[model samples]
Structures are given as C-alpha cells and as structure tokens.
Target: MATAINVQSSCSEAEWKARQRLAACYRIFAYLGWDEMIFNHITLKVPGEDDAFLINPYGLHFSEVTASTLVKIDIDGNTLDGSTYPVNKAGFTQHSLFHRELPDVHAIIHTHTTATMAVSSVEGGLQPINFYAAAIVPRLAYHKFEGITVHDDEGPRFLASLGKKRMMLLENHGPVVMGRTLEQAFLNHWVLQRACEIQMQTLAMGKPVMIGQEVIDKHMANLSQASIDPVQQGVPEFDAMVRLVDREDTSWRE
Candidate 1:
C-alpha cells in the first residue's frame, strides 16, 4: 500500500531524541563506508509507544537522512500508509522483528557493506580478530541468509537468533545490529563493520592475528560499564553529527 501524506500528530518530544540519533547513525555509517545507499535501514522504537517505531523513508541515502525525515510504522510493518513518507519492504521486515521482539532494544541497524556482507557470505561470520570484536563477543548472533528479508518466516528466525542479543550477521545476506539508543546502535554498527573489515583484512594478509579471549572479555566488560551513560557521549555526538550533515543538507529535518 502507498503511504499517507501526514502524521496524525507531530512526533512526541521523546521521539525527537530517537530521530536525531537515527540521523546521526546515518552519518557514522557513511563514515565507516557501511551504508548500502538507500537500501539498508536504521530504525528506532519510538519511546512510550506500543509497537510503533521510526525508519528512514525509502529512496534516501544514509548521508541524506535528517531527524524529521524518518517514518513511523506499526509492528506488522505497515507504513501507517497515511504517513507523509514511504518505506521499503526490506527495511520493514528487518526492523519489524527487532521492534516486536526486542523489548530492551530501542534501535536497530541493518546494512549490506563490502566487508560485512563479505564476512557474512563465508562459511562462518565475523571472527574475533580485533579489539572491536570484544565489544560484541558472545553477544553476536548469526542468521542464515535466505534472500532479501521480504518474507514473514525470516522474521522469526532472525528474531529468534537475536533473542536478547545486540548484534546479528544475516549470513549471505548482511548484518543487523541493535542498541538501547540510536547512538548506541550506531556505535554498534560502526564497531561491527570495523570488526568485519579487520577480520577480512587479517585473512587477506595470511598472517596469524592471535587475539586472546581474555583480552576480548576485558574490552567487552569495559564497554558494558561505559554504556551506562551513552547519552553523555552518544547523544552529544549525535547532535554534532546532525549539525555536520546539516551543513551539507538540512532537507532531512524538514
């Protein structure tokens, strides 16, 4: 169904933070070379809503996103068709599962980048080869790739594997990462992308990059503590990113 032309009411004030975070997530992903143009998605679960969330409108590049451009949707993946924007089926299916099943997770990022999808297509997913891998560690989950996530069945398998975890690699498909906030989720995707890059590069080098499990645990633990106040770091950084993107294009916030 085609989407509607207007929201019943303006987004709640609480949603403002989520929107800004979503936009910042775009800039960071672009910086990491992880954005698949307008195909991939970064969605946020609207604060204080029931099975309602926000996603970038269809047909916009990550670098082109702004706080006001994200569209709200229901758990069933409907665009509220009356929304003043449009959505793609890929973003809907991937984001719906996360918003529906992950209670603690407020944001989700799906990507198809060179290194990330490269690692995903392998017999195995990302290998713990660098400091960034520690941030994900045991929390990382993997989903077998079936195709583009357009079917409802993929939703269950994807959500089941992601059960309470923060990161997932959709094997042969791509990567899906989550967070408690837009900032946190964005950071997760960036680190996960970097980890994939590092893993791929190491394999390319053919040199053994021996990483100790204890060291990985240490870094993961440190990040757990640091996330206690992601706003201080994540929120401000998100604002700064929006300003940066705004310099190039402020149309998203329109």
Candidate 2:
C-alpha cells in the first residue's frame, strides 16, 4: 500500500498555495454536484514551474481530496512529488495537451454534469436563449466527441477544435473550461452550467425565444466595461464559494 506523503514541506511556497487552491476547487465541485465520482478532473499549472502541474489523485472522491493529496505531474504525465496515488490517464491525456500548448491557461476544468453533457449532445449546441447563454455563447467552441479522451492521437485535434477559445463543449460528451487563473475557470464553468440548465428547462417547455445578436454583443460590451479590475477576474466569486466550503469542511486545506 502507498502511504500518504507530506507534500507541503517538500514543495515551494507558491506550489503549496496552488495545491491548496486546487484541492479547494475539488471540494467546491463536489459541493456543487459537478463531480463524477472521481472520473472527471480539474488541473492547475504549478506556480514557478514550467512543464509541471497538479491533478486529483485517482480513486479518491472529490470530497476526499486535500492539499497534500493532489498529485504533481509533468506535462508528459509522469508523476512528480512522489505521490503514491496514481494519476488518471484519461484526465492526463486531455488536460496535458492544453497545459502544454496554452501558456496563458493556468487552470483547466472538465466535468460530466448532466446539463453540460445534454448541451453538448444537442444538435445546435448552446444558443443565446438566456442571459447566461448570451454572455458566453459567442466565446464557446465545439469539438466532436472522439470516444474517451485517453488516446494521444487526439491531442492535436482537440487543440485545433479549441483554437483561441477558453470554453469548449465536447459533442456527445461534456464541457472543458480553461482560464488564465483557477478562479476564472471555475466562474466560466458556473456560467456554462447555468446556461445549459436553463436551456434544458426552456426546451422542455416549448420553442424558446432567442436573444438578439445585437443584444448579446451589447451585453458583453457592457460586462467588459463594468469590470473594476480585470486582473481580479473570478476571485471574489471563487473566494465566496471557498468560504462556504470552509464552513462545511476545511479538511480540503489539509
């Protein structure tokens, strides 16, 4: 059996902080019911380290994850930091490609929520039919599902599909959200999840009214102009959720 390792003592201050934040993200996902029983992944690039990143240890539920338990691995999927738990190969296959290619994308989230998967499997993908959808529709990208994401051959195709977009819906699968920071990635996923949920509900009702392109553009413009500090994107919202999770269980910070 593999024993637990003291990760904080061995890592730098910045990396330790990254580990804590990533662990909290897992707990937040569990709290939001976005976790898929240890199947999905959320990865963050290790601070001050090139070609290295962090991921949840396989076999543990998201709620069981803690700062000390996240496995540090390189872009090529080799586990560093001497973590005993194995890395999820499928998670590595998908997340590594983006981390290697996109220098600006420090955080990546992949989930199999019903609403997101439903939106992905839909014919037209996400439409600008509601406020949440209208805000993100123009930035959303789509990639055809290529079965489970374990194969190395699919890497290039995934990159090509994403291009310069930060969010992508995998046809017949789920969603992948990337961000310059972890908080931004979480916020993006939140918005996308809401949009899909509302779309599913609206479709069940009847033919839904779509938002006008001009209105969506205007809304996006207004949002851009409303930011008090672009660099602090998603920090406030993510911190609020962190506080909620802390109230529930601070074990994730262990």
Best-performing candidate as measured by TM-score: 2
Q: What shift in Å separates residue 226 of candidate 2 from its native position after superposition?
A: 1.0
Clashing pairs in 2: none
Instruction: Specify the poorest-scoring 10-residue window by lDDT in model 2.
Output: 1-10
188: Cα error in model 2, Å: 0.4
Model 2 alpha-carbon drift over 4 Å, by segment: none
Q: lDDT (0-100) at residue 98 of candidate 2?
A: 93
Question: How much does each candidate deviate from the true structure in C-alpha RMSD?
Answer: 3.0, 0.9
Error of 2 at 254 (Å): 0.9
For all predicted structures, in order, the TM-scores are 0.85, 0.98
Residue lDDT tens for model 2, 1-254: 35568888889999999999999999999999999997899999999887999999998999999999999999988889999999889999999999998999999999999999999998999999999999899999999988999999998899899988989999999999999899989999999999999999999999999899999999999988996565588999999999999998999888
lDDT of each: 0.74, 0.93
* Model 1 per-residue lDDT tens digits across residues 27-105: 6677557777678888888789858998888877777776766787898877642556678987887778777777878
